[model samples]
Target: MKLNLKQADTEIQPQWQPIVGYPCPPEFEPSTWVKLWQQPNPYSHDEALLLCQLTEDEWVAWIPDQGETVLYRYQFFQR
Candidate 1:
């Protein structure tokens, strides 16, 4: 479990911003159970994305790709 924040060598707080909104589609109702987490990009350990899990099956990931924040939806495997 190694995190590669280049700035982790320095101060950590100001590097990240608070995610002000949730990117839920119309079918999904917002949940009260929320925890904020920063996960390193699987492809690039040097970067990270702010993510929140909506349910056991779904989550939203926000990335600052370039100068804009891009939103992506991830779904777990269904049985």
Candidate 2:
């Protein structure tokens, strides 16, 4: 799965799903205050970043652009 950075920054789309159930840990903020990936560039789907919110202010993403799971900040994005 790929992540659409532009859409995420502007508005929450249906593609952004709550990471729930067994995949999500109990320690995580109930898998409620977060959203996940959506392919931004169709041509570069494989290279798109996998964005996920850790908390209201803390956001983490698997940034394929930089090739790691690091903090990715974008404008217009809010919890």
Leading candidate by lDDT: 2
| RMSD, one per candidate, in order | 19.1, 19.2
Q: Write the per-residue lDDT of candidate 1 for residues 1-79, one digit (tens) a residue.
A: 9988676456556575555696544343232222223334444222323355555555554433422132333312111
Off by over 4 Å in 1: 1-48, 66-79
lDDT of 2 by residue, 39-78 (tens): 3344422332335566554545443333434333341122
Off by over 4 Å in 2: 1-50, 72-79
Per-residue lDDT of 49 in model 2: 35
Alpha carbon lDDT of each predicted model = 0.37, 0.40
Error of 2 at 72 (Å): 6.2
Q: Using TM-score as the measure, which candidate wins?
A: 2
